[model samples]
Target: MADQHRPGTLGHYVPYLLGRHLRAGAWPPEIGKRAILVLLGLLAVVYGLGFGHMLGNHDLSATLRANFLLGLYGTVFTSTLLVDFVPSYRPVQRLLPDHFPVSGRRSAELAFLLDLISLRRLLLGVFLAALACVPGQQRVALLGVALLLGATALSFGLRWLLTWGRGRRHPLVAAYAAVLALAGAWLTLAATKSLTGPLAAGLPWLVALLPLGLLAGQVAGLGPQFLNRNLVRPALDTAESQWLARLSPEWKAYLRKTWPALSMGLAFKVFLLVASSVMQAKHGSDSSRSIFYLVFLPVISFTYANNNLYGYLYSLTLNELQRLGLTSRLLVLYLRLAVPVLLLDCLLSAVLLVALFPASTWPLLGLLPLSAGVFLALGLWGSLSKAKPVYKNLDLMNMRNNASTLMNILTLATAATLYFMPWWWVRAGLAVSIMLTAVVPVRRLLSNHGPQRRQLHHRLQSM
Candidate 1:
């Protein structure tokens, strides 16, 4: 009976040990070395400045201190909110079953532990530790930093646990909603000056610990239970065929046939729009909002141009079209494809502006034509340039690369114009510049590289 009980005891501890091993493997070797160097460098700098002397001379006003704390807390909250939705860092659950010959419950326990030791937590810890040495009310500043880090970690852990409990349902949607609510509450508290002195001092330490305790409880017991249940169920596949198939009827049918490329383009646009809106709503001041609008307009326009270029290039399978004796048919097909994409750009820009900033409707109405012209030029150029055309079919990776490059160039140009001129006229000029740059070279390249035909008589004589 004692020997039989031993196996059950060992099984309970298996997840904890496996989690530690997995974390050790996941962390990059360079990160540990760099973290050590950074910590040492920070210590040396603080000591050289005479930490006590610097604190004595610190001129941080009450307002400055309050703002710094607010910013720090806001950053932590945002990071916690985004952690679960981070596409690249998602846990490798599929790999777990192969590596660990254990029950799903044990496997999940290990995954939870691995997540606790994630790079995100380590970086947040480093940032908080560095803040402790900053010149301020030493005890208050240190305490504040500690509270912020603890709260952030707790929030992150809780979010992950909830996600697992929900069978990993759209965590990002919930996270975004939570973040918005928190931001609203913080603003209200700040405006009322209720977030000061006693309330601030007492709340940080206590409130921070609550989440930590909750996180520990969830991880220790509930985590394995949720994981085992979730693992037994069939995984949810997000891949939708009907939506992708609908795109085939559109003018960009040739390109849309490559479902992956279409999906990626749509996903990227949605992500950018959502992220920008969330940031603007949470952090935008009067001055910052103005700056944001100025920056955002050009950035969105550049993105529109890049997407147009991608669609155009994807539709034009130059090598394949060259073999078919149907020059007129191919040209007609290209024109049909270009028209709808150009129109879509115009529509998307109008809708996005209205959705994000309804007050900017008049400005957007004026910007639409300019945007349309720029998109047309980009699309036409992309179609004309036989350079790296998607011959067999659309390749998502290549499309991404091409789109990124085009967007980067356009964005840089917009930036330069804004720096030198910084006016509506300058923005309009930038739009015109993008059109000229794309149109002229592309036209010339296409004319030169147009499909060549060999006479049948000459081919027969050579044979």
Candidate 2:
């Protein structure tokens, strides 16, 4: 039995991969060491200032302590998602042999490790561990551990979501819902400090252990729950609705390739709606921090996709560009593909505003439009200036698809304050102003038929 199990154990594969990575000097496959060094340096400086400011606070209040705890959780969770999702730090993955004798749980686990081990990821792990040193914070350590475990379990569900097994009845779907609910409850309880009796003492332990148990069951016990149907197709007609069929072929094709990100964004919007409503109900409009939460509504969808517009469609758009150069046709196609999402984004933002910040509803009517313009312009700029090579695998964990990391930062930063001066005329004027600014990127793209898209798409299929 020991001999039989050895082949399926991670110990065998991890040592091999670790040896290979160390031999190869730990350089990430698609990116260079210099770039990673630059980014890590910048991040170190920023993190140093930010954590120093927070740590400087010696006498923490209950609310401030609660806020810090929540912020720590959000930071750990978001950073894990962001860092893992982007095409970074996976070196030995490409070195896997074709006939390697890996199977079942072992195969899945090996695939994960192949992607996980890299110099950048290890550095990030160190950065995350430093959160424990912050003064007056005790739970940050356990919470971080529990969060990493929960996040791993959540990835299985998220991965299944990008595949065919995404309906309500699917086991992964049910698991996803349960995990999300549990996460919400965990934060809410942490904030309210109301985990009662024995439950309160064991809650952190449960959060840490339960996810590990769930992941073990899924990986080792659940046989053949993988979703691998319809990996690639020219048109997504199988899943198309009447509304989608009405679209032109070019539009439909573009939407077909990019539908998953849009769907993911829509999924986030649903959660935000529920979470925002709950927050508003508990705190009401009286909370000074409500607007800060509500102000991010326009950006939720952009985080998934819009901010990386060109990279998201590089595979398709490259062919079009070769035929047309960087002409008005390219700009028109970009606008056409973007308009519907922008409209939908506006509608969603409007709904959230009305639900939570009802008074600001009319004033912030231009919020989504302004956000759309700003990001579209910024995304276009990044496409020209800071694009990256990405894959088209529709992996649940991989959404950016060679997106611009700079634009990602700018997108969030811009949205954080987009609705800052949330007065009717002020927002409208800003919206118009940004829309006019878009012409600059349009001229930039048109004036230069840059070959970045084509070069980037060399590794991609025509889809």
Best candidate per lDDT, number?
Answer: 2
TM-score of 1: 0.57
- What digit string (tens of lDDT, one per residue) describes model 1 on residues 1-463? 5563342133545556656664563343567645654675566445434533444454957675565556556556555444544322243342253334444444544555555554444555555555455665466446545555454545455455444545345444354345356555754586456887776666556545555555455545554454433434333435545545455443344443344443444454555555566655766523234333333333433343333343334333334344653244444555566556445545654676568754733463565566556655554554343223233333321333334455445554544444345377866887788778864544443444333222211221221
Best by TM-score: 2
TM-score list, all predictions: 0.57, 0.62
Instruction: Tell me the lDDT of candidate 1.
Output: 0.48
RMSD for all candidates, in order, please: 9.2, 7.3
Poorly placed runs, candidate 1 (over 4 Å): 1-57, 86-95, 98-109, 116-122, 135-188, 204-207, 226-229, 232-245, 249-286, 293-295, 298-368, 375-409, 415-430, 440-463
What C-alpha lDDT, on a 0 to 100 scale, does residue 269 get in candidate 2?
A: 65
On a 0 to 100 scale, what is the lDDT of residue 239 in model 1?
54
Off by over 4 Å in 2: 1-13, 19-58, 70-124, 133-140, 153-184, 216-237, 240-247, 260-331, 366-463
lDDT of 2: 0.56
- Encode model 2's per-residue lDDT on 183-264: one tens digit a residue: 6686678667776678655665665556556666665653233322321112444656777878896676666556666666
Assess the local accuracy of residue 36 in candidate 2 as a C-alpha lDDT between 0 and 100: 58
